[model samples]
Target: MAKAKVTDEQIIQVGSELQKADKNVTGHALCKVLGGRPDRLIEVWEKHLLESNSDENSLQYIQLSAGLEELFQSMSNDILKSIKSVLATCEQNILTQADKHVENEKVACAERVSALREQLNDANDIINQNQDQIDSLLKENQIINNKYQKTIELEKSVVELSTKLEGYTTAIKDKERIITEQAARIESINAA
Candidate 1:
């Protein structure tokens, strides 16, 4: 027959002996711990510790006369309040730093906007200067074009005046020929 598994009571008795002998209680994590169900085995060691410490454990001996109990409660409350105050201070410091950071960002943004406006003004000034130069160049070009048109008209008038002079010269030569012929005829008649 398979030997029956060792009981939790038996294991507890061994653990107690080991404790009394000042030896390590369970050499390992209860993997080979004798006998009990696995779940019970785990709690068995804890039960041994409680059983051994029963008399010495303060929480088990609970005869608090109201006064000491109130003092302990007051002490815990004060500690909690102090902890909350420290947390609040830390939170306030974080908020202050965040506000300062936001202000710095706003100032930096304003400076950037001012710089961009200055650049825009500079660009506008350059554009106006270029436009003024363009207008002056256009006026000069108009003056040159007008002078060229007037020169062309003057050349046309000179050509028409030369044509009229040619016609007058031809008529004068014909009149001079007629007068010379009449003079010759009159001289011949007188001679006759």
Candidate 2:
């Protein structure tokens, strides 16, 4: 009764009903009951069924084909669902890996920043130490310069003292010569 192919089973069932009613049926009657053309091959097929034995092989082939079609449809649906599930899982894994990679990069960046900060701190410490050393060197140089200046002033004093000592020695020699001349004149007059 379904609106699709005219299956032989429906024809056979109608013929059986006609037989039970003790009424003789023909191909035209069967086609009329099935709401098809009485001159169609479907009517001839029904007539063949009434005359000869049914083609069991063809019937089996049709049944098997229908079963295979149903099975193939079911398998296709199952495969599509499985493929969708696998694709979703793959997408989730990709997202998770991306998140982990991002976190790792962040951690690496933080570590690098920490290392750079430490290096900067160390550099600052070195700079401060160098500054202290420079200051100490400058103080030492200033002290040395003061000592050199004092030594230069002492050398000038020594030069002036040496010049005065030479003048005093020349004056003492002149006085000694005059005393010797006076003693000689006194002895000569007494002798005269």
Candidate 3:
């Protein structure tokens, strides 16, 4: 006898039912339920497994995004603290220089003040650069969040499609039962 044709819908239905029953949805089990070649059933099973794995991978991506955001926040906080400490030390040095009494020391203090001003300018540049970097990181984080939201939406769509498939499967089964009952009635009348 020729092999029976198995539709993707039937395979999906069988897989869903097997999963609902908490049974192992292996190729062998699917073959017994579906009556197709073991190899073909295994291929279908592998495809299903891949789709599930993709969803799991998406979840991992979301977790990684969260971890990265936390790390960026920590780094930004540390940079801010370092900047504050540097500013405090600079202010203290300026105050100490102003307390000097000797004329020669006063001239030296003037030169030191100029050098400190240059250093302050350089520090401001660094702060500005760091701020730009933080802004860029924030933008990247926003992009990642958007991608995560899109992934969530895609997952929701998949669930909706599965629900619709189940409904269609039920309708097909009901029609089949009706056809079988009608055939039986026709046979009984012919026999009578």
Candidate 4:
């Protein structure tokens, strides 16, 4: 028995029913309704949808197929071969453009990485140098503190010595006063 040709409206109805299905209406489910294998129907449906929405570059096959009927009816073998070669060249050009874009992105990434590494190295070197300077300043401050402590001790000693010298001078003056009093008393007794 010959198979009946399915209509576009039927296909659309099956797709719509699948979309609104309460249960997971898988591609397999839609295929079963179409009386075709699930995988095959799903592939056809997806291809149809893609072709309808695809950009000019991605729709190359669909565009070519539209002209294929005319080309086959009127064109010679050489002309068909030339058209295929031109399509192949277009595909190659797209691939080359994609490769150049990837290469440019990679170079930019490498350059940015190298620059960041250099900046990090510079920052580390600056930190090291500043740490060294800080250490030197600390050492100098410690030395100055030691000298100030020694000077304070020396001043204390000088103050103590001055106090002792004042006591000795007071003692010498009292002894001289006693000696002068005894000499005056002897002279008075002799005159009497």
| Ten contiguous residues minimizing lDDT sum, candidate 3 | 95-104
What are the per-residue Cα lDDT tens digits for candidate 1 across 8-88?
Answer: 677777776767878776535343546445565657778877876885786767877799989988998999999999999
* Model 2 lDDT on a 0 to 1 scale: 0.81
For residue 133, what is the lDDT in candidate 2?
A: 100
lDDT of 1 at 94: 100
Error of 1 at 87 (Å): 2.7
On residues 43-106, what C-alpha lDDT tens digit does candidate 4 reach at each position? 6667666766776556545545557767765676778889999999999999999999999999
For model 3, name the residue pairs that clash. none
RMSD of 3: 53.8
Each model's C-alpha lDDT? 0.81, 0.81, 0.89, 0.78
Pairs with backbone N, CA or C atoms under 3 Å apart (clashes), candidate 2: none
TM per candidate: 0.51, 0.52, 0.41, 0.47
Which pairs of residues clash in candidate 4, taking residues 3 or more apart in a chain or in different chains?
A: none
Poorly placed runs, candidate 3 (over 4 Å): 1-103, 187-192
Which model, 2 or 3, shows the larger lDDT?
A: 3
User: For candidate 4, what is the lDDT?
Assistant: 0.78
**lDDT (Cα, tens digit) per residue for candidate 2, span 1-192:** 556456667777877787789977776777778866555534655576656655655564564478888997899999999999999999999999999999999999999999999999999999999999999999999999999999999999888888888887878787777877888888998999
Error of 3 at 34 (Å): 99
Better-scoring candidate (lDDT), 1 or 4:
1
